[model samples]
Target: MSKGLTRRSMIAGSAASVLAAPALAQELPDTVQIRESLSSTTRRNTASFRAIQWRAHFPNLRNGAILVDIDSRALHLWQEDGGYHVYPSSVPQSAEMTRKGRTRVVRKVVGPTWRPTPNMRRRNPEWPAVVEPGPNNPLGTHALYLSWTYYRIHGTHDTRKIGRRSSSGCIGLYNEHIAEVFGMTKIGTQVLLI
Candidate 1:
């Protein structure tokens, strides 16, 4: 074996900083790298799965569509090769998550501050009125605002809540996963909440 960087090194080093892409390595975020598989590992059991066995042949959506599959609790970033990027998500209750229409990405922000909605405040008056951008913020690292009223796709401080019905009404992802999606998605991107 040689002492130089090899293809195997890059794949194995995906999680660590030793793939040795020196200059470009500095630009890599500490966030989780994109999954080469369609499924995800649950933080709860580590060994257990969330049944995200999707193949990403987006039935109706095209390559550019962002499909948030509530049933699968997985978000698929439609790709040109019929293989999509999968991100685990914590969806709102079925009734609350279904917007019954197509919406477009309205705004995108990094390190978004989270201000409790009036409804959220009414539900929990003791909750803080606002949370500044930080590791503790409800909207972790980044957010993608939807055209629909108060709905958004954002990161969460608690990754354990992902792959379940945990969010008030918006979709939630692990901070790292949200970072990947936020970077790939752009304004005017079609969002189907179904």
Candidate 2:
């Protein structure tokens, strides 16, 4: 073959080989930005539990947290960046333990008053003549007030009965854990139960 024709043939063969290769065989397009996670310094602050003295020996738990697993009767506190603490929980005998939606934080109030809902009243006619917030309240030492429908993750006065089916539809944490969490979390954080 003529030298010029040979050069053209080689160029055509090279082009065909390049086109036949898998798309992924080539370097990623410049438009695709490869992202790296934040440095250690940028990780979420390990929540402080200074006010809850009982946790002095326990390590500070991770990022944005989580709670409740109906099937397991376990409450898991998860951090957004990745870490979790699991504790046994209790669900109500009458209350269904299904997690319907996203998880969020219990940002405010400890030892919240128990104002039994009209439904709660209907269930237990003698629930309370009038409810008030204090240590004597069934809510125990802490209640994590969530953003959706009057729900909370709290400590129950009855600790011996945890890890079973038994609350009015709130996620129950140990009193000590709730106090620590109540101090660390803030309003408007994400919460999920599954």
Candidate 3:
């Protein structure tokens, strides 16, 4: 092999590195920072209370990892300790939107506003251009924005929708559950959607 680097070789090398990078480093860090956690002290001590199915679902799951099981309609935050917190989640019913992959928690926000996408507005002409954060807002009270394209794991205005498939692409959790998940996750938290 010669010492000189070719353009094609360099491009290939860069692509290889990107493809092999850790899931957490796949995206740029967000401007927002998580400054607080929800009931961390109390939740960490409940490892003994986990059900057999929960443990069986992830035998070697990483700590501080967020796993979203689309088929099961559940979201789990594996605590820094050995315990885990499970919450019912509502995933998208659209086959094209039910994606399987890994992403990172890029942002966390309380009282998130809902901006109707152009496509959404096209589908529903009556849909408001923007919905300010409130009881009626679909984003509920908290949200964990993922690195994936326009997808967020957020709280829902309708608690009855939990454990059901009824979203465009984002994962929906109960208002209270999302609040806890928002507190539990931080920037760069690995989110596996399966």
Candidate 3 segments whose C-alpha is farther than 4 A from its true place = 1-63
TM-score of 3: 0.67
TM-score of each: 0.67, 0.60, 0.67
lDDT of 3 by residue, 78-139 (tens): 66554455666788978886777878888889999998777778989998998999988988
Model 1, span 1-194: residue lDDT tens: 57777744654576466334443224433233444442344533222222222233234433256777676676767443333456778888657545645677889999898988898899799999889999889889999999988889999888778878788888888888888888777687777765
- List the candidate 2 regions with Cα displacement exceeding 4 Å: 1-63, 80-83, 94-99
- What is candidate 2's lDDT per residue for 1-194, written digit by digit as tens? 77667743664555456446653353222121111231232111111111111123223333355645565565554443333345556665554534456755636775577787677889799778565776567777888777766678888776654666677777776687777666556665566665
Measured with C-alpha atoms, the lDDT of residue 139 in candidate 1 is 88
**Candidates by lDDT, descending order:** 3, 1, 2
The CA-based lDDT of model 1 is what? Answer: 0.68
Candidate-wise lDDT, in order: 0.68, 0.56, 0.69
Relative to the true structure, candidate 2 reaches a TM of: 0.60
Using lDDT as the measure, the top candidate is 3
Kindly report which residue pairs in candidate 3 clash with one another.
Answer: none
